[model samples]
Target: MLDLLKTPVLALQDFCVLCGRALRNIVRRPHYFDDIFLQMDIIGFGSLPIVILTGFFSGAVIGLQMTRALQTYGATGQIGPIVAVTLVRELGPVLSSLLIAGRNASGMASEIGSMKVTEQIDAMRALGTDPIQKLITPRVIATTVTLPMLTIIADFVGLVGGFIVAYYLLNLTAGQYWTPAYQILEWNDIAQGLLKPFVFALVISLVGCFYGIRTTGGTQGVGRATTQAVVVASVWIFILNLFITRIFVNV
Candidate 1:
């Protein structure tokens, strides 16, 4: 029992230490701007098509379903605001973050885990390079910067999708569909919408790096780390979303 508890406790401690170090390196000298931009291109632009596709369909589906529900009370005109609020406040960020975690988290884990198993990380240390600063910090910064931007794009695309459904199916004109959607958003909603993605970006990037750095068992370990990174990042996204929503709910 003591042994079982020890592993998780130690892993948690190591993860915390890695997070602290990586965050501290953010403002340090020898900034790897090139690597950071490469990661942003990989994580941000590479994930764009899927994010937009899913965002549109998700909002369209919600519009379809809500149209039915709202029609029960002859409130079909309210579909715009409903879809807008749901996509902006929750679905847009959550879905986009999940997609990003699945794509980039696995990539980070595999890339870094391969480096670990191949002793490349050791080689970097031998050459007087800080692996955390050179590799992990760049990823953290890229994810942090790009995730909120992606979430914003997702929210906009989703609103457009919802508008299509509303216009065609519900006979809502552009004004009817867009006006309330525009008016219903507040500073609080916008704040939380952006904030959730920022938090998720940190979790996804750090979890991937942590698992990658700790990988063992050679090739098998790299695969395991990749899988764990995606799963853990995705799980933490949901868990953190709940906590953030709870905090914002009362505010």
Candidate 2:
């Protein structure tokens, strides 16, 4: 048990060292904007549709479920606030983060792992280029910056999804649907959800790049790193969700 615990401690230390080095590289060698732009496009813009689909389903489902439950008390109007709070507090950030993880994390792992296996990373080092600074730093920075913006888009589309279900399917007017939504929707809730995605982005980029940089074997190892990146980033995202929620509620 003690030995197993120490393993995690060692991993955490390594992760910290890598993160610090990557951060410094980002600051020192700032000419790597092209890679950063590509990372942003892939991690943020590329994943928009999946996040939209997720938000739509999550919002529709919430309305459907809450309507069914609230029908017993004839308080169906509460659906608006329910959707609002869920979108701003939970569904928006969580689903957006997960979508980004699926795209950015997997890609990051594959790119770095393949580079490692192809000896391109070593080639960079031989050419007096810093791989961490050039590759990992740009990726990590781009993802962290893009994630929060993606969450904002998710929240908007999610609310629209809820509105579609509530008014169109349920035979209500826009005013009736939006009344309760605006009542409970707060800027702080939106802020809280957006904040978590940035942290989630940091976690995703770091874990994916770390596994990729450490990859061994060949194509199989790269594939394994890709899978591990998605899985680990997802698990950490959900865990972070609980912690962020706890802090939001406390504050």
Candidate 3:
């Protein structure tokens, strides 16, 4: 039993250590503004189209499904509020983070893992360069900055999709849909919408870096790290979302 627990425990310890180091590097200089912006372009802009597409369809699907149930109670007009709240409070952040985890988390792991296996990281160490500062911190900062923005975009696009469905299928005027949707969102909901992605961004970047920096076994290890990074980041995103949502709901 102790043996069984050891690997996971050690991994958790390592992950926490890596996270601490990466975060600490943010305050310490050699701030790689160039690398940060480059990663932002890669992870942020690169992921944009999918985020928008996913947000739109998810909102449309929710709108379509809500129509029948809502009509039964003559609550069709409530669709806008329902969609808005769901997207803003839950789906938008979760889905956007998951998409990024699948996309950029894997990429981060693969890139860093390749560098690791190739001894490039070791060479950097020999040259007095901190790999965490150069490689991990930039990705962390970029993801933290971009994920919230992406989540916001996702939420807005999702609302638009819901509006389209409501306008056509439910015969809700733009005013009817937009007003309730706009009014129903509280500060708490907005906070949750923004906060979840920020937290998730940390998880995605850290997990990817952790798996990456620890990679061994050459090419096979790189593959393994990439897969683990995506899986772990995605799982943590959902887990954290639950806790975050619970906190907001109770607050």
Highest-TM-score candidate: 1
lDDT (Cα, 0-100) at 99 in candidate 1: 96
**Residues forming the 10-long window of minimal summed lDDT in candidate 2:** 22-31
Pairs with backbone N, CA or C atoms under 3 Å apart (clashes), candidate 1: none
TM-score of each: 0.99, 0.93, 0.98
Candidate lDDT values, in order? 0.95, 0.87, 0.95
Q: Write the per-residue lDDT of candidate 3 for residues 1-251, one digit (tens) a residue.
A: 99999999999998888989999999999899999999999999999999999999999998999999999999999999999999999999999999999999999999999999999999999999999999999999999999999999999999999999999988999999999999999999999999999999999999998999999999999999999999999998888988998988864
Overall local distance difference test of candidate 2: 0.87
State how far residue 250 of model 3 sits from its true place (Å). 2.3
lDDT, candidate 1, residue 175? 98
Model 2 lDDT tens row, 153-180: 8887887888888887777678888887
Which ranges in model 3 have alpha carbons more than 4 Å from their true place?
none
User: What is the Cα-based TM-score of model 1?
Assistant: 0.99
lDDT of 1: 0.95
